[model samples]
Every structure is written in C-alpha cells, then in structure tokens.
Target: MASRYHEVYQSWKHDPLGFWKTAAEEIDWVSTGEKVFDPDQGQYGRWYPDWECNTCYNCLDRHVEHGRPGQPALIYDSPITGRTASYTYSELLEEVEAMACVLADHGLVKGDRAIIYMPMIPQAVMAMLACARLGVIHSVVFGGFAANELATRIDDATPKSIIAASCGLEPGRVIAYKPLIDQAIDIARHKPDSCLVFQREELAADLKPGRDHDLGALQAEAVVAGRRIAPVPVKATDPLYILYTSGTTGQPKGVVRDNGGHMVALKWSMKYLYDIQPGEVFWAASDVGWVVGHSYICYAPLLHGCTTVVFEGKPVGTPDAGTFWRVISDHNVVSLFTAPTAFRAIRKEDPAGAFIQQYDLSQFRSLFLAGERADPETVNWAIDQLQVPVIDHWWQTETGWCIVGNPVGLGLLPVKPGSPTVPMPGYDVQVLDDAGHPLGANTLGNIVVQLPLPPGSFPTLWNADKRFFDAYLAEFPGYYKTADAGVIDDDGYLSIMARTDDIINVAGHRLSTGGMEEVLATHPDVAECAVIGIADKLKGQLPCGFVVLKAGVDRSHEEIEKELIKLVRDKIGPVAAFKIAITVDRLPKTRSGKILRGTMRQIADGETWKMPATIDDPAILDEITEALKTHGISV
Candidate 1:
C-alpha cells in the first residue's frame, strides 16, 4: 500500500497538471473547462481558471442530493455550555440555505467581504458556509484577538458586514465579544454597514438599532418569507476567503483562497491524508480563526460527508486533563487532530497516563499533530500512551492544507520521531541555501517549494498582490520561500528544524532553537519548553530556555536547570551555548497554544515589547520578566 501511494505521488510529480485535472473531475463543476493550470498569467499560477462551481454545494448540498440526507454531518460538543447537538446532511443544508437567505436579505452580494468573529458555535460554521454559498468572501478573525487587532483586520479588509456572537464561553467565564466588536468598530476608520449578532442565551448583549441585527431573528424571518437561496455558481478564480496571518514586520497579510482549487484539494485531503470515511467522526481541537479549523473543523469533513466535531472547550479547562479522551470516546472519533502543545499540557497535568486510561479510545485510529513543530519526545509519548501512530505534519497558514504528511489513508509508514514524513503529491519541497542554491542532505537551509504551488494554496494576498509577491515569490524566482529552515534526510523525510529567524547565529554557526527546545523537552523534569536567542557580544547570540515543570514534581529550580543545561549539551552538542534555563509556572502562549518566543526574546534583550493581542495570559509575561530580573540579568 505504501508503494502504491509512492507511485501515485511520483505520477503527480511527473505530470502535475494531469494529476489535478483528474482530481478536478471528482468535483461537481458547473462548466468543466480544458484549462488545468495557468502559470504565466501575471506571474502567479491559477488552477482550473475557467471552471465554475459553488463551494457550499460541493461541501453540503451534494451529499444531501446523493441520498445521504439522513447521514450525520456535524457533531457539536461544547462542555463549557453543556450542550451537545448533531445535525444531519439535510438539516445542515436547510440551516445553511436559511442563513444564505438572511445574508442576501441584508443586501450582501457576491464579491463582498464579510468578517465573522464568533466562537466555535454552529452559527460560525453556518455563516462560513452561507458566505461560500453566496460567493461572498468571508474573513474569520480569531475569537481571542483584541479589539485593536480586530480593528486592524477590518480596516484592511473593509468588510461590508460583521457577524459576531454575544460572548464566548470559557471555563468559569463568558468572554464578551460584542463589546470588543463595538470597540473595534469605533477604532476602525472603515466601518461595516451592518453588524449581525448571535445572542448567546448564557450572556446576552445589547444590539445597536439600525446597525446591529439579530442573526437568529433574521434567519427566522427568511424562513417565514419562504426564501430559498440557491447556491451561487462562481468562477473558479473567484476569491473564497481571506485569512490574515501575522508578518514579521508586525503587519498582517490577508491570504486569499479561491473556490474551485481549494474545494478540490481539501476534499482530496479528507480521504487521502486523514483516512476518514463518510459518517465517521473527525475532531480537530482548534479555533475557527486558524487554518486548521478552516479546513478540518468546518469544510473538509463536511466536503467528504463525514461528521466533523466542533469542540467548544479547552484541552484542560471546562473539565480536566481527560477532556480530549472523553470527547473521542463519547463521539467515537476516528481521527483526532490537534497541536503538540495540547498533548504537552495534558501530559503535564497528568503525567502518569492515569486520566487517559480511564477512557476507551479504541475508536480513535490515528492522531495527527500540526500548527507547530512536534518535538520527538511529545510524539513518542503520545504514540506510547495512545497505542496508535502519532503523525506529525507540516504546513503554513498560506498553504491552507498539509504539504508534508504521512498518508495514513494509504498505509502507516515507519514512524520517524522528528520528521513530518515526505512531501504530499503536489508539493515539490526543497531545502535551499541563502543564495537560492539547493543544499545537501542533513544541511539545514530555507525551506522552499518549486513553482506552481498546488491547488488549494493561496494564489495571492487579498488586495496586496505585490506584497505577496515580494514576501514569498520574489525571494526565490522559481520557488515559494517558506521562511522556514529545515533539512531532508537521506531517507527523503523532511525535518523542519526551525523558522529561519529562529536560527541563532552563535560564533558563525547556525543553531536551531527548535532543535534545542526539543532536546530540553526530552528531560524528565520538563513539561513544556521554549528557547530563544539573546544578544551576546562574545558569541553573537546565546540560547535562553524557559521551562514548565510537571505538576506535583517538587524539585529545586537550580537542580532542574542544571540538568536541563547538561541535557541540551549532551543531545544537541556543547556549541549550543544553552546555559541559561529559567523555570516558569507556565510558558506564555496564544489561546491556540503557540509559545510566545518572540515576546520572550524581547524581554531577554531588554527591548521594549508591546503585549500581543493573541496572548493567552498577560500576567505570564510579567512573571517571565520578574524571573529574569531575579537571576541578576539586566532587563
């Protein structure tokens, strides 16, 4: 089976256009054209340029039309709100059509952008589908983003309407979203003509007259008026959505995904990467704001006629460390996908594997990790605890889907502890030196993809095509600069070492901070760890490590720090200069569990740093600052 998969991959590499043309036939295109790919058109490639289709029809309506109307399409589980609901294919279609009518009734038409700022509720998914149904471009901001951050996105997108919920239910608290939306509207110069609020009964919000309207009430009115909003057939090149990702310069770039190519690639991924079948449950424990959520939680599973779980609770909160196991066991989830940070948290809170043993996870077949590089320690730990293959894949927000992954849908390959397996069928991944020359095996260099990025990948930035070209395409003439450093081993497996910026130049030798962090994570005392480079006059830069110890493990900070330093020297080599190690109660992270290493570097360098809007806890930053100051380090 593995050989067969490799054969398919080779065929794709040999004839990329033929591969995509075959895949395109699987979708319900309104008018299938002969064009497969256009690479020289304005220098940015476009896929299936002359095709026409509706994304919602491919995701929702087609499944219902094929006599699978009663099949379960969505399973919403929100422990915070104590709600569990299931929607069938037919039911989801009705809800989506009703919401589409409501959107149309509000004077929203094709080509208009709608900003959706809501939690992991059913409405969020419905709103996204409705936008796709009407050919309206939707931009979903992370629910945890601050008003200023939201305002920045609004100003850039200039959305015609905004959809939000009253509040987001977290553990023991309700985060008021309406107030933030209102504040962002006040701050942003380009205001939306309309605001639609989904009033969560747990915490209702005030609606501004003539500006804000009730989403549910509008849907009800549309239903009462017997409005049947059919899916709009849009050109293949029409923009589907705009997702904003942070740039190194502190500005955000809106990555644009088109309808036809995105639909084809995502639908293929559902069966090809995850090995999910119709009616099986697939749960991705990520927020809707992120790309993982956009692909897996909302679109991919539904596109393949599978039941996607929309989880509205944290990995550790609203319950306990066993929250993930419980969700999988209760829902019979076949494929469980999440970040490595989540597993690290669960391992920290319950190290003995006690909580996990309480549940029957036999239904869970494979566990996939992404968002950040998966340390070998965490990957091996999950494999041992779950008794299943833990596959670590790599992709970016710009790509919109997995570029490097183990095709579990075909067969399980030999597990490489630190590698994210081989490149998928469409990605021609290569490691290039700073001068755009290919590097040898085991040599870390910038990760780049050869020209003609696969379907479903972002074609250009929204309203900033030049910025996109300068940021990605222009760096290497015939390659998309990934801005990540990695190496391909002798076995052809790619190991992402670190972000290019995260590589510390110590004594003219490049050291991967991520590699050092992985080494530190192997220490028995360490629960979670992050490494950042600080300016050093003698060595150019030195590695600084922050660690969170396992719960209930009472060990002296000095003792653990000493062990960690030696661990890094032993594993990564003595040249790492990994002397400084500070034990923190918790590492600063975003709500999505990404470590804030940049913020840590700012504090370590004694430079002024503004608190990021996406930070999960501002107090943790203060704690880190105080800890550094206690060590007699100048801050």
Candidate 2:
C-alpha cells in the first residue's frame, strides 16, 4: 500500500495546533480547554496548557468503563523465574486503585514527587499508574543502578516516598535492589519520608523499623478495606513523570513529560506511527527504566486499549536465543519493538535464525528498532529473518516519542536501509551547519528540530529552566538542538550518522564514525563493530575500528581486520584514512545499548575520564583498553 505520509505531514505543517487538537480528542480528556498551544509559557512554549486530564484514567479506567473490563491489559512474562501473569483492564484498575489508596493514606498528594526503583514486574507498572492516579510526579531510576547514581537522582527529584523491590534477576545472578536504595538514601542530602519495598521470592529484604514498609502487605490491607480512589485531574501541562537521561554524569538532569500532550501524542502514535490497534497485544521488549519502556511498554499500549507485555528476560541467555520468539508467539503479539543490539545478539547466537522457525509468528505484523543508528547490515538481516517490515526509527529521551520514523499505519514509505525514513508529523527536522545555517539535501550537518517541539517532547528540565535553555535551546537560537549529526536526503529521509561529537575531522576533511561502522558491518564475519576517531599527530585524527566476530567463524582475526580496513577505505574513500581494526570480545555500551564511543575516544587520547554511570559492565572498558593496547593505541 502506498503511504499518505506526505499528505499528513503537510496537514500538520499547515496548522500545527489544529492537527494536535484533533489528535487530542482521541484521548478521554477530563476538560479539553480552549488553548491548544501557548507559545509564551515555557522555554519554547507549551502544549495544551489549559487542558485538564488524568493520564491514569486514560490508561486504565476509561477502557474498563467502556465495556472492555474483561480484556487483558497487562501481561507479565518472566523467563528467569518461569512465571507468567496477565491482568484484565478491570483487574489492573483494581490493583492500581488499591495502590493509589495506599499512597494517599500515606499522605502522598497531587504534585508531590515519588521515586520508583523496581524490576520488570507487575508491581512496577502498578506503582507508576498509582502515582499517576493521585497526581504524584514519579521518577523511575533503573532497577539495580549504582548506589551513588541513584543518590544523585534522589537529590534531584527529592521524592517524598520511594517504591522499590528487593531484587532484580539476571540470567545467572540476582541484583539486590534494597541495599542500593538504602545506600542512595544514606548518601543523598534529601531523605524520602517512607520506603515501600516489594520482596521477590528469590530474595527477601530487611525492612527498616521506622520508615520501611512492605508493599505487598500494605496493598493487601488496602484491598481489604475496599479502598477505591478516583483518578485526580491535573492541568494538561502538569508533569506526569520525570525521566533522568540514562547516559549522564555529575548532576543528574530529569526531563519532564506533561500529562495532556503525552497522552495525546502517544495515543496517536499507536494507530498512525505503529499501526497497532485496540485490544491487540503490543510488546515493547524494553525495561521500564528507559523512555521506550515508559511510553510503549507502560503508557501508550494501555492508552490505546491494548495489552502490553512486561518482559523480564534478556534477548538471549534467559533461556536461549528463542526466548523472544516464544514470548511473541505465546502472547499473540502483533508488534514487537526492541533495540538493534538485541537482534545483533540473536544473530550472533543463531546466525541462520533456526530458533525463529521453532515458533509460530503468524500474528506478528512488524518489528521496530531504535535506541541507536540501525546499521544497514543489521536492518537487512532482520528483514531476511523475520520476513516482516523491519522499521528503523529514531527519537530521544527528551522527545518521549518518535522524531523521525516510518508511519507504518499511514502506510509505510519506501524502505531506506539506513535512514529512519523521515520526520514524523510533529517535527520539522533540518540539518544545519555550525553557524546555524541550513544545509542542502544529503549534507552531513547538525540535526535540529525547529521549535516549539511538538506535544510530548520535554518542555524543560525539572527545576532548571535556565539549564534546559543553555543545554538545548541556547545553542541553536530558535531550534532545539538534537546534538546528533546526520543528513536529510532530497526525499526528506533522515539518516542519523552519529552524535555531533562523534563526527571527527581527518586532516581537513570531516568524517562520520557511524558511516565507517556501517561499512564494517557489511563484512560477513563481523557480528558487531564500533568505529572511533583516534588522535593522530600527522592527520589530526585517524579512524580506529573494533569488531566482534560471529560464533563458529574460524577465520583468522588478522584476515578479517585487513578486510574491514579495506572495506571502509573502499566504501567511504581514502579521506577517512581508515586504519587500525582490532578484534575485541565486545564494544562498551550503556545499559540501553548505546555504544560508548566518546568514552573510547577519551581513553585512546589519554584523557582523564570518569566511569559512566550507565555502563553495561565496567569490566568491558578493561577489555576495550587491552584491545587498544595491542594496536599500540591506549592511554
């Protein structure tokens, strides 16, 4: 089917407020006030500031009241514990009501902040919805974050209550969360009033006498009392949640998501952007800690009246590479959204996709990849294996939804292997040079979205409007600087090549490490790869590549390294000066699967650097350093 993306985009371009106001009606708004947008409200204006709504009501009660009470609303699948649970819309609303009553009984009120630190469980979703029910602004720090890192968020958000769990499970290990929460509370200057701890069967926690409360025990008590709390109405512009960006240092910065616009945008995305409809099973196989989990996993699916999966397992090693397929097949999932790193991992384990054949994916319609630039090799590999339209979309934590994507429902545009397709309805994406001048089609330049960034994007940093302006808006004047370097083709497809910092200069020529990584991915034996610009005395900077080979590849590493160097030189030209390809076990990545390229560059240049708070494993950096040492390039 041919896409009407151009028609819809033009409509949005012609009248942004009218487009959003029409979309806003899809949600069950408490009061759809007159002003669709107020341009003078914040750093770059505000969306639906006067509109009043309850995010929790749209996600839960509305579906139940509209004769869909028996439909499944949330599914909890935990391969680690071999446990599965499903909740109907009515059942989920009951649980959220009980939890909200518990919170209200403990004196949590509208606008008071709460922090949720829990694993991927039914309780975590309940906590978030319950907070939303009472208009408490909640912040979710990823389960198992370091004590000091959690402390930084505790100081920043300064929640009055904390909802957490005892432990989080990995394939071969159990991460104790209670101790980390305790330690964070100890380190932070601001102390939360109470801590609600959920005890997993694998590991129980020791609750503090005065302040700590058992979550299960309190929730049971609330249910016994028949406490049913109604969803509190809040101004559309009032904050729904605060999500601290994953890869950060020093002081933690929290991006605030507004209740009204967040509901309007995500609900619209479910039908138009994702093309999944009501009552279908939609699974975003991401942890609730990140933005993907917040929007797709927790909020969007529920708002759209779809059953959302809360998966507690890895892409592999939870059982095997077949776990993902099993979950999709078992749940009758129609759409699956995950990061590209997951597919690469599965591809590395089962290159032939033999595990995929063991399950029936007749109901699965499409696969969406994000969280990083989806290299063409990985994208093509997924297309071949799944025989589904593998879409590569791009967005960020601040935006809360897609900036550039293929509107699968509006009808997908022609697939471009590397580009994320094009800017979505709300974004006016452009490529601009250093001086803030617009660049022509297909020119490598800074990617900026012309402000005011549509509904659902963060308006400002929590409690730091000046810092938000300085960090995002001040640099580009009227545009919100994405800080990513990319090219928009003549057809308007946006190709995210790298972060602005990742664009390196070789002699006098600007080059993209992402472009080189794409070339390296084409190598048959390379399972995963990363490219960084290393400092060089003669050329100012030289390209350095690292690769991890596929399983059962018996070819010599030296031979593959030589091929990779030639592949980049041939594909990107000699101006890249591509040299130094090293074979490593893995590339350093954040917990969310973003390669730590900037950190790798810092190490190669012998610059002092602190350990990233979001590093997947601190030990990976040691492996990277040793691999660099072999190539005579180390700090």
Candidate 3:
C-alpha cells in the first residue's frame, strides 16, 4: 500500500500529465489516445481533450488485463434467508456475458434502453455490466420504489426490456418484486417488450404466468450458445447511464452522465479521496441506483483495480444494526463510506456501541459521511464512536462525486460542524451572489464552479440539452451554478447551508417537492400544494406536504392523504413519498403566486406564525395556524 501511494504521489509531483497518461494505460481501451489532451473546439477550456475509451473496458476488462481475473469482485448477502454469495471476477465476467447475450437475443440492440428494478444482488451488478457490454443504456430504479413509481420511470426511459427478481430482502423482510413489475407493466403507457424475472421461491406476491421470461432459463440458453460476448465500441460522449434526481419541483430530472468524463473523475477521486489500496477491502453503504453507488461502489474502485464490498442486504436488518460493523470486522475493510443518517440510527439503536468496539477498526483508516447533512452532533459522535477520523463531504447528482472533502488527514483544513470540507484538486469553487459574481469568503451564496466543468461533471442533460445549459451554464456564463447555498469559511472549508431552490434534503439526498406537487395538481380535487422539509431527529429533515383542496371537493383527510401519497409513489418512488401532509384550505402565498414555504416550515416547527409581508392571503395564515395546533405544534 505504501509503495503504491508513494509511486502515485511521486508520479503526480514529477509529471502530472505523465501520471494521467500512465494511469490511463492501466485500463483496457477500445481506442488509444491519439493525443494525451484534446480540447476540440475549446470545450471546457482544454482540460478534457479528445480522450477516448470504452467504459466497460475500463471498469470490467481492465482487471483481466492485469492478470487478476479470478479475484473476488463483489460480496453479496441476503440476511432474510441466510444466503451469502460471492462473485469472483471470472464468474462475474461469465454472468455479464450470459446476461448480455440474453438481452441481445431478446432484441435489445445497441443504444436500446434497459431498466433494472431488482435488489442489491450480484445479478444487479451483472445486469449493469451486461448493458455496458452491449452498449445498452441502463436506467436502474431503486428496488424500494412502488409499482406506480416504477411504471413512471419505465414510461420515461421507454426501455426495450425490464429486469427484476421474484423476491428480495429489504430491512430484514422478504419482498415480492415481481408483483411490482407486473403491476407497473399493466399500467405502463410504454411497456417493455420483454420482462426477465429472477424467480425466488420465497415470495409474497403471486407471479404472472406467461408474460415474464425466466432469468434462469435465459441464462441456461446463453450457456449453450458458447459464443464470446464481446463489448461493442462506444464513443466517449455516449450516454453511460441515466439516473433520476428527486428534485423539489416534483418532476424528476434524468441526469445523463457521459462515459469517459465520469470514469476519469470517479477513478481519480477514489484513489485520492478514499486512499484506496490494492488488495484492501472497501465498503460503501450506498445503493447502486444512487450516484454514490454509481461513482464509488462501481466505477471508482473498479477503475483503480481494488477489491470492494457490495452487500445485498440492508445495513440495519442483518440480525441487528451491528451487522455493518460485524461485516467490516469480518471483511477487514480499510475504508468505509456511508450516510450519516445510518450512523446516527445505529448510535441510537446500539447504545453500548459494542459491535463497533468489538471490531479491530485499526485497519479502518478513512470514514466519510453523506446522503444528508451531518450536523456537528453526528460528526463528533461518529469520530468519537468510531475512534477514527471522520470526513464529512458534500456533492450532488450533478457533480457526480465528492467535490468537497477533507482529505484523509492530509491537507485537511479546519473542521466545521456542518461544513462540506474543502474542494478537491483541480476544482475552482466559489460562492456566488444573485448577480452571478463571486462573493467574499464567509459570505452565503450559491455554490458555483468558477472554472470549466470538472471531469465528473455531466456534459449534457438527458433529452434536455438546451435546458441543461440554461439551468446550469446560461444563468452564470462560464460558471456552473450548483443551486445550493453554502459558505466558505476563512480556512477554505465549505459549509453547505441549504438549497437555493424548493428542494428538500431528507437524510442527505435531495427531493424536489415540485415533482410531487405536479402529481397532486393532476388530480381534479387538488387546487394548490406546498411541500417543505421539516427538521427531524432521525432523517435531519423530512418532507412535509401541505395541500389545499379544490372548492366543493369532498374528501376525507385519510382518503386524500392516501391518494396524494399514492400519487407521489406512482410519480416518483416510494423513497421520495414517505411523508405527506395536506390541509383543506389554500396555502399562504405571495402576490406573485409563490407559496410561502418558509412560513409553512415555521408552522411545522411550531414557531409563532409570522406572516411575511410577501404573503398574499393574511386570513390563510390563521387557518394554517389553527392546523398547526391540531398537530400538537405550539404557535
């Protein structure tokens, strides 16, 4: 490990460009670089020049090139049924080939879309790799999504096929996944032509008879073919994956990240930020559907040619919340990354912290917190609890990976309670005001990038290229607006305050309320809706929706709540709709038709309801006040 880091550091200091060139050589490439750097037409100011490589070649085939094909790649566990699974690189390659062949045989050609709605099994990774092998753009929806939410994503992606399992474990219980797929397909406006289901014997929901293709059967057929599953040549700018963002606007945005840029950035980040050592186990408690998983759990570690852990079961449910610590102890993971929310929950559930103390965590060198704001309390608790340096970093779906971080004790600036650490190397960060001009240090403003987009920065939006430029680039010429408000302290550490938009952060992930409101507004009985994040003990903040019923609309509170909740689950995923509150009267608003969401937040917090002069309806304030009292909130 020392030799590897020393070699990289020496190379980086002696000749940075040469270091990149050598690093690039480590991966298998379909097209070698004609020039080390090629900035065609002055795109992003010469940083990323005409770089070329296939993503699959870098992520999967690169290991085989280094003669470590038989090394273990993914460690999976299903706690509900006491099933433990491991996949070696060779085994993974074969499964990837078989899955790719199955897709190709089912009319899934290059550029076709494939949706994977399954648990965190090894097959899920196989499915993703299979798509990459065949150049099929994959959209992986989290398995916890409801039927309606799954249907909406399927409608949006319009994939050629949908892959799922019959049952899977979540939070200790076995869940029926096929029923969700079947229900989603039944109502899907743009249903897939093929549905490949991995049937499990222990399932809660009944499976459909003939409409679904058996995954085992398909794999058997692929084994008989005996043909090599060669990867299709893909351009650097080709779409690698489409991950949806849960924005405040209630309308999810499909963030399209290019292959070459993301791969380069994530790889560099893993090697530098996590200090990944070869042969050392790395565990990141993040779902593959999330950007954390996309960057760290899959791309970064693989690109760096390091061993990684990918548990299929939930962190809390494998016999208790101690499962994570036990796994780390069992696997001897050197670097661990997870949400601060999970750590807090574990702390609350495990008073003795026995599981954490029982493990010899001396091997664990680095710990990172994300997925929601980690308040000072949680950060200090984690550092003391884990007895290791805890690095709380911040980034978003748009940024792709950690843009702000406190390096593993090296070059680490000051520690701020709720701060997002410092910017990474090669990044130029600034806090910009409404005029788009840079603000002085310690001033609050929207966090923006002063220089050209970074390596991990997504170049375009999915089906909304113009909108992408308008939202991120046009508003601030030559700068990318992050839409998040934060302050950079004197020591240069960034403290993320809040989003500039109506988006709510539950745990650490952003959820757009506008998207949920769009679904509610679609219902004839709904007149207006407002959603905001109320402070919570567990999740940092949870979305609390306040809706106004249409005139003469008759609906019970439970019925309306159920229906509106259903609407969100159908429109987005279940993870985005766990909290919804509705009021019968019109929401307090400004004359410009803007909902006074801050006022609502105050009401939810049980503070004295003070109507800002910007509010349009003063009487509506009284109604909201009365409603707050009903919920045991004092005003």
Question: 198 in model 1: Cα distance from truth in Å?
Answer: 0.7
Candidate that would win on lDDT? 2
Model 1: per-residue Cα lDDT over 1-635, one tens digit each = 54456887999988899999988876898897778888765447799988899999988989999978998888899988789999998888888898998888788999999999999998999999999999999999988578989999999999999988888887888899988999999999999999998888988889999999999888877767767788999999899999998542477889999999998998888887888887899999998898999999998888888898999998886699999999999999998999999999999988888988899998888999998999998898898899988999999999999999898886767779889999998899999999999999999999999988999999998888789899999988999999999999998899998889899999999999989988898888888899999999999999999999998988799998999999988888888988899998999987778888888898989998888777888999999999889776788
Query: What local distance difference test score does each model get?
Result: 0.89, 0.93, 0.70
Candidate 1: pairs in clash = none
The clash number for model 1 is 0
Model 3 TM-score on a 0 to 1 scale: 0.76
> Model 2: what TM-score?
0.99
* Residues 295-331, model 2: lDDT tens digits: 9999999999999999999998989999999999999
Output the lDDT of residue 479, model 3. 80
The candidate, 2 or 3, that scores higher on TM-score is 2
Query: Whole-model lDDT, candidate 2?
Result: 0.93
Please state the error at residue 286 of candidate 3 in Å: 1.1
Ranking according to lDDT, highest score first = 2, 1, 3
